[model samples]
Structure formats: C-alpha cells, structure tokens
Target: MAPGITTVLDVRTPAARRQLAKTTVDLFRNLLLLLFIVRYSRVALTYLYGYGPIASAKMGYAALRKSLYRIFLSLPGVRGKVQAEIKQTLEELEKKLVPSGPGITRYTALPASGWGPEQVRAELEKLHEMKHTRWEDGRVSGAVYHGGKELQDLQMEAFGRFGVANPIHPDVFPGVRKMEAEVVAMVLGMFNAPADAAGVSTSGGSESIIMAVLSAREKARIERRVTKPEIILPETAHTAFRKAAAYFKITVHYVPCPGPTYKASLSHVSRLINSNTILLVGSAPNFPHGIIDDIPGLSRLALRRNIPLHVDCCLGSFLVPFLERAGYDTEPFDFRVKGVTSISCDTHKYGFAPKGNSTLLYRSAALRKYQYFISPDWSGGVYASPGIAGSRPGALIAGCWASMMSVGEAGYITSCHQIVGAAKKMAEGLRSRDTLRNDLRILGKPLVSVVAFTSDTLDIYNIADAMSGKGWHLNALQSPAAIHVAVTLPIVPVVDELLNDLEACVEEEREKQRQAVVEGKPKAKKGDAAALYGVAGALPDKTIVEDLAAGFLDCLYKA
Candidate 1:
C-alpha cells in the first residue's frame, strides 16, 4: 500500500490479490487471442471462399440443381411425357403469337416484283389477321394506348399521306420537320416548360433516356472540364441508365430506395454526390412500383450543388403531368421544379400514341444540341443526326402527332382519370382481404397507374405463376420479390375480374401449403422464377449472374 494505491487493493489478503492478478491476465490474454483470430480468419476466409474447392462446391450445387431439373425431364417414359406437354404448350403460345399458318400468306422473301396498291392492301389484311392478343381491347398493359377506331383510322390516313416523308432532309420533307417540331412543342408545353425549353423526338423511351444522359455527360465535360464523369441515380431508375453508363463510359452510383415508400432516400443520395457526379436522376413514377421519388428535394439538391437533375417521366409519361389537373393527388415532379435540367417522356405509353415515339426535353436548346451527333470531316459530306437513328420512319411520327392532336389536353385528362381510378379501386380491394391484407402489402402508396404487392408469408413468385395460369400476365419483380400490374384502359374494364382471380389464387396457395404441413410432406421448392432470382440474390460475384443473363439472352435467339 504505497501513497498511490492506499488500501484500495487490500494487498494484505494474499489469496484475493492472487485471484485478481490471475483474472486480469486471463482477460487480457483472451482479448488478444480474439483479435488475432478475427484478423486471421478474415484473410483465410477471403481466399477460401473466393476460389478453389469452396467456390467450386457452390458452382457444383447450382449446376446440380439445374441438371436435376433436366434429368427429371429426361427419364425414359417421362422424357416423352414431358416433351409432349412442352410441345403442346409451345404450339399454343405460337398460335397466340401468330394466328395464321404458312399457307395463309407467306412473305418469306422480297417479292420478285412490287405489288400494286390493292395487292398491298390485301397483304396488309392477311398480316393483321395473323395477330392475336388484341391490344386494342385493353388486353395488354401500357401498349396500344389509344384504341378508338376513329383514332386508328385517323392515324392510318395520316400515315398514308406522309408515308414517304423523311425528316432527315428538311428541304425535301418540310411537312415532316414541322410535325416533329410541333410534337416537341406540345410536349414541352404540357410539362410546363419555359419558352426556352426545347426538345427532339426520339424512337422511344430508351433513346430519350440515352439522349438525356449523353447531354449531361457532354455538358459536364465541356463546362466543368470533367474528363471522368459519373451519374447518381436511384436503384429504381430504368436499366437504360445502366446502358448509358456502359456505352458512354460514365460510372453510375446507385443509392437504395427507402423502405415502404419505395422512393429514393434523399439523405443517401446527397451523401453519394461528389465533384465527378454530372447528373442526378429521379423518376416521376418509377416502373416497378410506380412510386414517385422526392423530385423537389432532388431538384433543390441539384440546384444547391450546381449539378444537372433529370426526371424520368418515361413510364409516367402523360399520366403524371396531368395527375393534378385531372383531380388526382400527386407530388410535384416536373420542370416547374427549379433544378430540373431535363425530362424524358414517352409519347407511346400514356400519351396514347403508337409505339416508337418519345420526347427528350431540356431546360434550354443549348443542352439539347449536345445530344446531336455531327461529323464535319466525313468524306461523304458533313453528317448530322438529331438522335441515334437516321432516316426515321415518317409514318410513326405521323401516327404520334395524330394521336396527340386527337386526344388533346382534355382526352389525356380523361384517360388519366379512368386509369388512376381503376388502379385505386384495385388497390383498395386488395387491401380489404384478410389473408392478403395481413401477409401481403403494397410496395408504396402508388398514386399512378401501377400497383405492386409482395407477400411476407408466401412466395410471391408462386402467386405470379398462379396469376399466369389464370391467363393474366403480370410483371414479376425481384430484390425483395414482388409482382405488379400497370393498369390500362383494358384493365380498367376488368379490374374486378383481376381482383377475384387474385383472391382465389391466394386462397388456393394457402390451402395447398396447409395440406403440405399436415401431411408431413416437404414444402415444394421455389418454382422457375424463385430459383432464378434466388441464384441472382445469393451470388456475391456478379460476373456469374452476367454469364447467366447472357445465356438467357442467347436462348432467346435459339431456334
């Protein structure tokens, strides 16, 4: 007990001092041992799990699962049985896709001689007959927007009038140029853009998105002298942005969407921004869940940071801009927001136009000009094109213009009402179910035409398959797994049918699961979608998924 220690230790008690000393030493030794083990284990596991036998085992498991499925189909009598079933299914699908047989009207090669007008008309009729899925009946979603016979007739007449027109040469096709300009002007006005706002028509939504990205990248390079550029977007943004990143060599920083809301987390987005970030993207109503992001906040952030903000209104299209005017509740997400530099809207989607039409607008003409491709030193004279494609189809442009003109402002307002009204009704019906209400939940407060739902107590993919069996094609989503339906004019007419089918499918699945439990049978493993998505979610090395995706694409082209 020196001056510092005093009687605190009670050193006089030899047994107590001995026990305390031993305890202190043991605790220190254990702490050091834990640190050493943790440090070494990380390094060992990195190498062990990264390659060699352990990695090989995981691959083997995946291959075995795939092979087992194949083997099940290959069993002697089973092979014939399964092949017959598959053949029948394929035949049915082909019948649906193409209703006419080869004898009906063949166009295998170019005609030795051009057909006359009446012959062309007859050939067109036969081609039309071969189509099934009457999208005009509203059987399809987000396709064939305006199905009125009057509009179709008008579009057909307009197309015939300008069938040979090309906007590539303004001198030769002044009318085509004027129509394209007017279409862009109308869209700009619809979005509440300033007089200075300008745009160019594109082939479709993907081109519009790509053009916007290209403009942003060029602006960053020229204005900020940024050689290496990057863009920040929500994970919910369209895959087109990923394509843009790959094509333009721009790095993409993806921020996670917030839970329940399914919108981009503003805080995380702000945190990810750096000097290299040239563009920030927010979707007016993202496709998967149809949840609009906090565009105003994103715009303000862009304004404060002096970065470009792009709002993707592609899926939302005409529907979003007119939501408020149509007497529906919606958040502000357009050029009216101070920081929005550009927007992409699909004239083909809710705009009620034919396919292959979209508009990419900018805050100023200078911004739009950057999207143009020009080669002044070309040997074949100066070359220029406003978008990716040259010699564009004038008939498609004519059809788009006619649709817009016929629908006008009031028509769009009315369409929005019907579509959104139907969607809300469906959402309400789903929300009222006890089993589905408790186990399944909507992804967000969907204010648009799409409603997505996922289940906590069942495999949503199974429900998707069930819906498919009922002859309804709903989109299947992953990464927390859900399914969504984009309500359209056709869906509006048959929403009650959809809801009834959903209820029956859910009940049937619940009962099947209950029986499996009672009979002591192992629950059925995940179906095709779950197995595919499960592999995608579990793989940390993304290259494996890339290979899988590539293989899937290759399968599509196979005979």
Candidate 2:
C-alpha cells in the first residue's frame, strides 16, 4: 500500500480501483436524480396547492395559448401585419401625447445662459394653456382632488415656506421634520392605529406600497429565515404590489376577484398560503371597480396562517375613514383589524394633499424597522433611510401637512358625504335609468367614489370614446370590458351630467351597432379607445401591448 492509502480499502489491483470508481459515480448520479425529483415535485405541488386543479389547468391553457400566439406572430405575413399595426398605433399614440406645431419650440438642450424668472413663468403659462383634458371643469375622473381655492393658496404658501427643505437632514429642517412626523401620526390615528403603531411618509402611493411590501419581505427573511418569499395578492390589488414583488425577487400568487362582488376570494387566498408566504394584500375599494375586499375575513386568515396582511388604502385615503362619519356605508380595513401589519394611504387623492405625498403605516415600530435601510459601514459614514427615498422633498410634506390641517375632520366628513353621495347617486342612475339599464350595467356594488359600468348589448370601449367626445375622461377597464368614473370633488355637481352623457353614449353605440347591421357590415369602425382596447383584448400574449406602452412612455419625453 502507498503511504497515503487508506487501510479500510485496498486499491492495489486494477479491478478494485475500477469498482470503487463505479460505486462513487453511481452514488453521485442517484443523488442528482433525487434532487431533480424533489425540486420539481415541490414546484408541481405548489402550483396544485396554490391554484386548484381548474385554475392550474386554465393557467396551462393560457401558457399554451401564449406560445401558439407567439408562433403565429412569427409567421412572415402575420409578423408583417402585426408590426405594421403596432407602428401605426404607436404613431397615433405619439401624435396624441406629444404636442408639435410650428409655433411650439422644442427645449431639447439647455440654453447657454439661464432665463430670468419672469421668462420661465411666461413659458410655464404657455405650457399650461396648451390644449389638454379640462380636469378643472370636472370632466376628468380622479385626476385632481381640488380642496377649494383657499386650501390651494394655503398649500402654496406652505410650499413656499419650505421651498428648499429636505427631510433627510432633520437637524437642518426641524419644522419639516416635525410636520412629517405629525402627518404620519395624524394619518395613523385616522386609520385607528394602535399606540405602538408607526409610519413613514413617502413620495407617493406607489412608493408607500413598495415600502410596505419591502417591509414584509424583510420581516419574513429576518424572523422566519424564508429564503424564497411569496405574497398573495387580490387580483384587483394595486399594480404596485406586483412591481414590488418583481423588484424584490419574490413570487406572487394572484387570487381572482371574480364578479359580481369583484372582491378577493378568501378561499383561494387561503389555499395559496404556504410556509414561504410572507404577506397577504387586500385593497380597500380597489381602483377599477371601487369594491373593497372582505378585510375581516382576510385578517382572520392572516392571523391563522401567521402571515402579515397589508391593506392598500391609497385610493381609499381620507374618504374610507370618514365614510361612516359621513353617514355612508363602510367596511373594516385599518390597523384596528388584527393581523394587518401595514397599510398604505395617499394624502394626495382624497386627502387633498399635493402630489408626491403618501404614508405607509405599520402595526408596530418593530415592523416598520424592517423597511428602513441602514448602513453602518460606509466611506461617507453611517447612513439610514426610513423608506425608499433618501432625501425627500419637504415642500411636498409641508403642502400635505397644510392641506390636512386646513381640512379638519368635519371638513373631510363633509367632503366624504358629498363624494360618496354623488357616487351612489350615479350608480343608482345607471341601475334605474331605462336607457342606461337597457344597455349598461354597473359592475359590483361600489360603496366608494368610483362607479364602474359595463354594457351587455354594446361595446363599452365605444361608449368610452363617445364619452371622450363629450369631454368626459373616464377610466377604461379590461377583463370585463368596462368603464369607470372615479367621482372626485369636481365631479360631485356634475354627477347628473355624467349620467346623462353616459346614457347618450350607450344609446349612440347601440344605434351604431344597429346601423352596422342594417348596412350588412360585421361591425362599426373602431374608435381610438375601441381600437386600442380591441387590440389589447385580442392578444393572448401582451408583448405587443407592452411595446406600445413603452412607446407611449417614450412619447412623454419627446420634445
């Protein structure tokens, strides 16, 4: 035996060495096979458990459809037609979004010398005067939440006071720091948060939601050692949650919010929960249909499963909290509900705060700590941030604080009464009006400011186009082919106008369909909204839509 040979195994003979090598190779192969089976088995089981057999089958069918659609798109003629259509659509989008004229000067490059303040103001006035959606007159839905001229003036004054303030350096801007803390505290109190609850202001609703999702992910990783975290979201939950999951490298299990309630399915959410699930999400009056999920039921599930629940009240904002006080129906969705670890609310929407102001509330300070990013070792020295942003604009914080202070509880209750009252009235008109009822039907029972409706006899997108022709900007929805009017303060007095316009659009679309049939045509020509949504609905794979959307974003930056 050699000096390094083991006494337990004699490998002096060629036959012995060959047998040992074969045994070692076989052992490794078996291990690899076992690992492959274990990994795939877990994946298969997760799918079967998260989505039931029917839903899993549907998912498989959708994947197959996507593949087939991609193959079809790859064909020479089909590819050419698709590319041509997309190019045409993108051109139309650019024309609509990017204004261009002989008189319009493109500011593509900075001037050699900065212009005077008066010159810049004149240019801004010119920009503001350009043709655009007249949201001030209340035709638009949920874009601007005006709090009267007085409130606007006050917000402007506050902004001027803190023009260059940044909340990152609290010592330098103590007043802004105080205002930020008070704003969070006030909002937490509005949401019925406990004494131990904590919150941080963020740039907007999207950032607030992202922070909440990040907090849950961090909490799960630190406490439960969950390497592969997952989240269960209602189908109608804000898209920011999906964006957050994508950013954080977490898996998302979207439970369907099926009609007619258009709320998350508690049963499906329950089934989706596993040891790896980090958080559960519910929307308070989701954006599309304005239907609140069953939060109490979701809370119970969250408690039983020992997972955190985050209620997205960004759209709900000040209105949901004041609903009962305003003498309107409401649902349970706040920190008061057990197992709800976090909530996101936008002061900009119904709170009448300026843009770029939102808050994320945690059930306790410990939970909120997870969202904080602190670095102890850095060349620049130790640094910490409460949320995603590093140096936040204190002017927006001041504006938010001023807006909230100017609009006291009584004021919010009154606004809530007016807004929700108008929404319910619109919903009632849509349901009871003979012409509107004949063609259109409201989706879900909307208790919030958004009233969504779809038509069974006519194309809803066509009706949206007709509404646009009448200067009413309504939000178009998919999956059910619907349109929604998010009733704001501006829209309160115009509720009757909205109902009348919607009725006329429905009738007009019906007449067009009738005329098309009389002319021996398959259907009428598609309008802008009809054409865009038609293309979107027809595609099984949304790569084309994605490209068009990217093009639209590009148009936004075009001079």
Candidate 3:
C-alpha cells in the first residue's frame, strides 16, 4: 500500500502510522475473538446435539490423552526399543499359539497327491488333539456351549443337509430362509417379545450386536437427524459394543459399574445422555462381572430420553429367560421391559445351536428396517441384505433351528437349571469361604451362568494362571482384577472339580505370596495371565495392549 501510494498510506505521518498500527491490532483482536467463538460454539452445539458439556469434556480429555500417547510413541528412539520388545513377545506368542512341537504337524501347503476325505478327517482329529484349552472336559469357559450328543448329532445332520445353502439366494435355498426366520421368531418369543416384534439371524453375538448398533444409529439419523451419534455402555458391557462404535464412527461413553453391586451407575448414564445419543446399552449379566444392569431403571431412562436401549443377552440367551423357572432370581432385561428396543441373543451360547449362530431382535418392525441395507440403482441389479452379511451360512441357521426345536422350552429350562445351578454352586462355594480362600470375594451378584470372583488379599490373575496350570481355562478380567467361569451344560457336571481347583489355586497363590514376602520380595507368583492382565491394568498407555492384540490376531492366521 505504501509503494502503491493508496489514500490511507498517502497520508504517511506519525499520527497516521499510529492509527494504522491501532487498526492492525484491532483486526488481530477481532480475529482471535472469532476463533474463540468458533471453538466454543462447537462445544455448545455439541452439548445441544450430543453429550452434554461434562461428558464432552471427558471425551475430549480422553482423546487428548490418546493423542499425547500416540505422539510419545512416534519418537524414533523410544519407538525402536518398544518395537523390539514387542517383536520378541510376538515371536514367543507365535510359538505358544501356533506351536509346532514333537507331535504337532504344520500344514503350510497341499501334499503332492490329493488326500481323500478320510485322510482329511484323520488329520482334523489329530489337529483337534493338539495342546488346547480342553473345552470338552468342562475345563474351558464360555466357549463351546456344546449341547448333549443327541443335540450335537441333530445339529450336525442339519449342517450336512444345508452345507451348500446360502440364505442370500432365498429362491434357491428357501429352506434356509425359513429356518432362519423360524429361529428368530422362536428366540423372540422366548424373550417375551411383542407380536409386532421382528428380527434377523446373524452369524454370532458380535454380528448381532453390530446390527443392533447399526439399527439404532440409522433410526436416529432418519428420525432425529442425528449425525454425530453417541452410544452409552455400562463399564462391564460386552466389547462388541465398543467394536461397533469404532467401526460405525460413533462416540462411546462408559459409566462405571461401582463395587459391591457392580450395576451400571444409572445417574452417570443419565448424565451422559444428550440429543445425539442414539443408543443406550445394558448387559443382561454382562460378560465380565456377569451382573445384570438395572433394566427397569434403564427402560425408564430410555423412555424419558426416547433413545433406543439394547440388552446384550448374548451370554444370557436361554438361561436368563428361564432363570426364574430354574429358581434363580433374575432382573427384568428383555423386550418385556418397555423402552428396550433390541436384544442380542447368541443361539450358540445357550440356545444349544451350532457355533456362528445368533439373533438380533427389534421391539418393532420399524426399528428392524433400519438395520437393512438396500440399493435399487445398482448397475447389475438391486442389492439388499437384512443385516451385515449378504451371503450368510444357511447351515448355521439350519443348525440353529434344529437346536432350538430339539431343545424346546423344556430342554432350555432344564439347561438353565443345570448351568445356572452350577454357577450358583460355584458362587456359593466361593462365598462359603470354608472350602475356598477367605481372601477371595465374588464380584457383584451374578444372576446368570457366569460367576466372577476377585480377591482383595491375593493376585486374581495369579489365581487364574494357577487354575490354568490345573488344566482349567477361565476368563481373566481387569478393572477389578477378577476371573469368571461361564457355566455351560458341560461345566454343570464338573462344577465340583472347578471349585476344588479354584480353592487349590488360591491356596497355591497364597503359599507363593507367603514365600515371596518371607524372601523380602513384594511381587510374586506372576504367570502368563498375571503378567498379561497386570500389564494391561497398569498401563494407562494401551498401545502395548493394542500391539499385542494385533499380533495375537496375526498369529491366529498362521498355518
């Protein structure tokens, strides 16, 4: 402007220069004010549309922590050492997970000559005998909800009948479609769903959870125009909900399930809700603690907020509905509760179905539609799918149907009595403190098949490792540092063995600790589980856990 001699600069004197400088400062101040407004306006709008200021601030803080941790890990010198350690751990993990020992054979490629079905079956038998968790003898938890031989035989027959069937081709495999529909209907009925309720069969509990989340998000989008969706979960809710949030770009809020009862803090959940909250989740005997959230309270909150609430009964399934019949007290946590929009039931868990079978039921048809995907303008043809997968395994659906039918209501009731009874026995044994260690305590009131126990005076993870050493596979939980056993039909008979091993493991750990204390050592009796959960619990930085998890997944694919 000075060079061009504009009118303003043409009057270049001391006073004029001072005036120009003043104007410049004023402009800069205005700009800063504008920036401040924009930043705060976003937060204000976020409060108006999403989680309120307190929750938003919490989320922002968590994000900041994550970003800072990421930055810390990005340093070249620090990264290299950490990576080297991770690599060594992964290598050791590979040996343990994908081991090739004396009796083990690694099949990296096909043989020169083609093998017959008999040879393949023989190889499979050997492969099955490899060092494993021994789920068959009821030493394993949650996994392999194997029904009796008769039920398994029926499921196998159904699978063989529909081995090549795909539900996507409804016309071609109408039987599979019918079986799926019937399975859903039967499951919904068991959950006390309304006449207008509808659902779709999914691959498993994870898929069912995914679809329920997707439906809630979509419904919010269409009805409330909520773009920035947020979901609320109990601290003990299944991890699938978090996975769904990550995949679907939804904000997740966790409300602590406090000690003693371990129920979701309803007040905290209420505070977390905002206009953009698409879903609220309560676990019907959530995986870790196996304690049901207050579904009635959740329902009241959902009704007041007009948000979809999902009951994750993937672990509960057949057992929960029949708990009362089985003489086990249960909280209301299903379609019977108003404001509960969806439920995820793993047919594989308690429905006595084959693995890879579950159902997601909606309270109404309108809610179910949101989970569907359709495109009429495709080049080839119109494409539509009920849930996530387009071409689902009809065999699994058939097996699910067969299992449900064979078991019927009576069989499920019997199973509930057996499994939940075993869980009750375990819980009773732990609480008795006469047979088990007095230092250990049960986590909350587990009303379902899963019974979680923690110890104030003992390292729970070390106890888990000791149990593992005794050929028992149980889930090690963090946050409270506990272990859980998911009672199944198989575990029902071996409940005594489980309690005995648990008591022995606790005593073993106590002795180890006593020895370490005498040797002037503070920490002792660390095993695979102890080290794993201890690290996971201690680290505020989860990058190590993430790295380990990724490597573990990679190991799963190794031949």
Candidate 4:
C-alpha cells in the first residue's frame, strides 16, 4: 500500500485519531518514567546488591538503635540527668588534665614588653621540666620515636638553619626543595615505586592520607565522571580515612576486620565494589592490631574492578619495607603489589624524622597531579600548590632529610630488628606468663612493632588504668576493648619492665573480679579508663562521648 493511502485510512475516523494521539502521549510518559527510574535507582540497587541482606539488616538495626537512643535522650528527666553527669565528667577531666598550682604559672597573654634572651631561655627550661609522662624513659607508647641524642642534635641544627625557609618558593630556597625531593625519592625507592612514580611531602600521616583520598576522588571525577563517589575501607584502617571522607563528601563502606587474623575481609571488600567505588584501602599493619591486611588479595580486587588501591604504611613506614632484610615475617603491601595506586608513609614515626614530615607516593605521576591545586584565573597571579598547605616549613623537610640520610638503610634495618624483637618478646611473655596468659589474649598475629591484647576474664580498661598508675601510658582501643603498646626505640631497653607491669595489672584485675564475685557484688569498681570507655561503649549515640572528647581538647588549651 502507498504511504499516503495508509495514513488516510488510519486517520479516517475521529475515534481512531483520538486513540492514536492518546497512545503516543502514553508512550512518551512511560519512556520518561523508565529513564527516571534507571537514573535514580542505580546507586540504591548497587548498595542493595553489594551489602546483601545480612549486612543491610545489621545496618538497619544500628540505625534503629541510634534512633531509639535519640528518643531516650529527649525524655524530660533523662536529658537533665545525662546533662548533669556529662558536666561533672567534663569538670573532672579538666581538673586532671589542666595543671593548676602555686608553683605552676599560666601564660594566657603575651608580656607587655619583650623579655631578654636569658629570661626567655630560663622560662623555656622551666616549662620543659613540668611534670608529664616520662616518654623519654619509654613509659609511653608510640608517641616519641626517638632516634638518639646525636640525631636529635642534627635535626635541631637543620631546623636552626632553615627556620625561615618555605618550600612554596622553590626559587627562593632551592636547597630546601632539593632536600624535599630527595626525601620523597628515598621513600619511593624504599617502597619499590617505579621510576615514573612521583610523591609529595606533607605535614604528617593524616595529611598524607588526606591527599591520597583526594587524589582518588579527583581522578574518578575527571576520568569517569563519577559524582557520587564512595570508598571501601577496612574497619581497622586509620580514622584519618573517615576524616577525609567526611571532608570530601564521599560515602564510606566499612568492611569488617574479624578476629583470629583481624585482616580485612576479602570477600566483603569484593562485594562492596561498585561503579562509584573510587578507592579501596588496606593498611600495612594497622595501628590497633598491628596486622597487615591481605594486600595481595585487595590488589587483585582493585585491578579487577579498575579502581585505585591505597596502602596506608603510615604506621609501618621504614619498618615494613625492611622487614625481609631485618629477618622478620612480612607481606606484600607496597608498590611491588600490582594495582596499588598510592601509598602514605609517615617519615616521622619509624623513619626517625621530625614529627611534622610524611610522604604520599603515587604509582604514576599522572595520578599524583590530581592532588595538586592550581588557579590560573586569579587576579593576583597563576597559583599552584602541591598539597593542602600553601607555605610548608622547609625546616621540617630539611630535618626529615637529615634524619633519613643519617639513619640509612642499615640503621633502619637494625632499628626495625630491635623494635620488632622487643614487640615479639612482649607478645611471647603475654602468651607464656602465668597471670597474663590466664587473663589476656593477643589480638591477631602481630608481625610488627605493636602488640595489642584484650582480656575475656578481666576488664582490659582496668588493666590500662593500673598501668597508668604505674607511670606507663598505653593506647586504648574500642569495639573489642583492648590495649596496645607500640614498641619504639626507647621501649627496646625496657621491655622486661613493661611485661612485668602488665603481668601485675592482669593479676590485680583478676583478683578484684574474684573478690567482687565472692562478695555478691554486680561488678568490681571501675577506674577512669574503665568508666570512660564503658560509658562511651554502652551508649548508641556517641554525642556524649564527643562532648567529653571536646572537653578534653578544651582543657589542653586552658591556661
């Protein structure tokens, strides 16, 4: 039939014409609805499939618990009581943290007139002598990674020489620039990075991680046009990753690091991968448990998914790369592992550098450019920065470079052997000693310089408080309630004393538990750590805990 004849026949009747127009409108409406569904439901469907039913149910339960807590806190009498208790807790915290006595002087404001150099020096000496944790005596965990008095003198000299130099003006301070480049190059070589790899120096570990996260996010946005970015992180990964996600407005999917191995769950990480997953993170001996995640496993997943993988060696630093040379057990975590796009290592920790230096390395220079900040349209001039800070202290870079140069690979290997050996000895004592073995169990198989342990038969926080009373400062972990001692160079000589104190604390806590049971008491009396962690863990909403932490921070600034 002819086209004109068919059109004439089809539209010959008024009812037929009306039906055709209605059908056309219906088809257009249906097509628009289908497009809307596909666009809006993609992310939701990905989450459903990725998390599956069991994990989704757990998430739902957690949300419900949080909601219930909000309702409970809103109750009339409950709110008042909780507020009063929080106030009392903050007061106690302030009193303990802020020193106030006749002998102590508060410098709230600057002096009306400048003091002489001798007067300033005297004041500085007095301030340094104020009573505090004896980190120099190895009583504190992980805070001071001292490289010895000679290295300290070298660092001080470097600082004194480059005090006013800033790396932002490389032309003005070319020596500082050269030192910073050398520091990055040296660390990249340690991590087995390729020749085309590039890196930048940051203030510390947290900034390095933040830069890595930012790099991944920016790359995803520019290359894949992924606006709603998400990252998969092991639960044991550093809190800095969470801070980065919060700052960058990215979603985080936390895969659990279960016990026994306490490594990231490979299956869960694989399940969580989706189109929006810009990055996957695995730690090289995470801070809490000192257990390296299955980086090889994560690498395979990252390669298969075509997403970036970041290995956080901030804690491991110089120690991890030298593990094999130091004759210790090791795992594949650095650039030698395929599909690892970036790594963050703290030169400050194990590198024996000053506290303000760390490096973020990339597998390729192209990936690192995503972390750079540039503004060409500014009226002032074309501006660019390598990282978050505009003007970084060249003094820190010089100090870090000097430390690295002084403590060469041979020195680092020896340091690693000493620190790791001490840690292993502590773990062995915990396992073999009578009181410790009976009450406590080590978390994971720590292959590094940190040994974390928890107790099933006794309160771990009570043990922590007891250690504190004995002039030892240990790190407290939550979720499973544990304590960790990060063995540094200073702690190498005092391992036996640490083990002895730990044994005594365990025995004391155990005896107290037994006495409480015999007396028909519900529980033993709680100490400061016990009470603080206990209350924090029991509440579903962490607002009170946040407030307490904020109060502690405020006390640090109180004169």
Tell me the tens digit of each residue's lDDT in model 4 across 1-559.
Answer: 6666645436778998998899999999999999999986885666677778778778878889999998998899999998898899888888778888787788888999999999999999988997899999999999899999999999999999999999999999999999999999999999999989999999999999999999999999999999999999999999999999999999999999999999999999998898889999999989999999999999999999999999999999999999999999999999999889999999999999999999999999999999999999999899999999988898999999999999999999999999999999999999999888988999999999989999998889999999999999999999889999999999999999999998888888888989999999968988898999999889888888987788788888888
Winner of 1 and 3 under TM-score: 3
Q: How far is candidate 4 from the true structure (C-alpha RMSD, Å)?
A: 3.6
Q: Which pairs of residues have clashing backbones in candidate 4?
A: none
Going through the candidates in the order shown, the clash numbers are 0, 0, 0, 0
Candidate 2 vs candidate 3, lDDT winner = 2
Q: What is the lDDT of residue 386 in candidate 1?
A: 89
Q: Number of clashes in model 1? A: 0
lDDT of each: 0.83, 0.92, 0.88, 0.93
Candidate 3, residues 1-559: lDDT per residue as tens digits?
4687656463468888898899999999999999999978965774544455676687678779878878888799989998998999899999888877786677788798999999999988977777787788888898889899998888889989999999999999999888888989888898999999999888899999999999999999999999999999888899999999999999887888998899999988887788879999999889998899999999999999899999999999889999998887988988889989999999988888888988899999999999889999999699999987877888998898998888888989988988888898898988886746487888888889889888889998998898988999999998888889988888988988888888888888889899999999989958898898898887657988999999999999998
TM-scores, one per candidate: 0.79, 0.97, 0.90, 0.93
Lowest-sum lDDT 10-residue window in model 3 = 43-52
Report the C-alpha displacement of residue 402, candidate 2, in angstroms. Answer: 0.5
The candidate maximizing lDDT is: 4
Q: CA lDDT of 191 in candidate 3?
A: 91
RMSD (Å) of each candidate, 1 decimal: 13.0, 2.9, 4.7, 3.6
Query: For residues 261-363, could you state the per-residue lDDT of candidate 1 as single tens digits?
Result: 9999787678667777899999989988999999999998899999999999998999999999889999998889989999999998888778889999999
Q: What does candidate 2's lDDT look like per residue over 142-193, in tens digits?
A: 9898988899999999999999999999999999999999999999999999
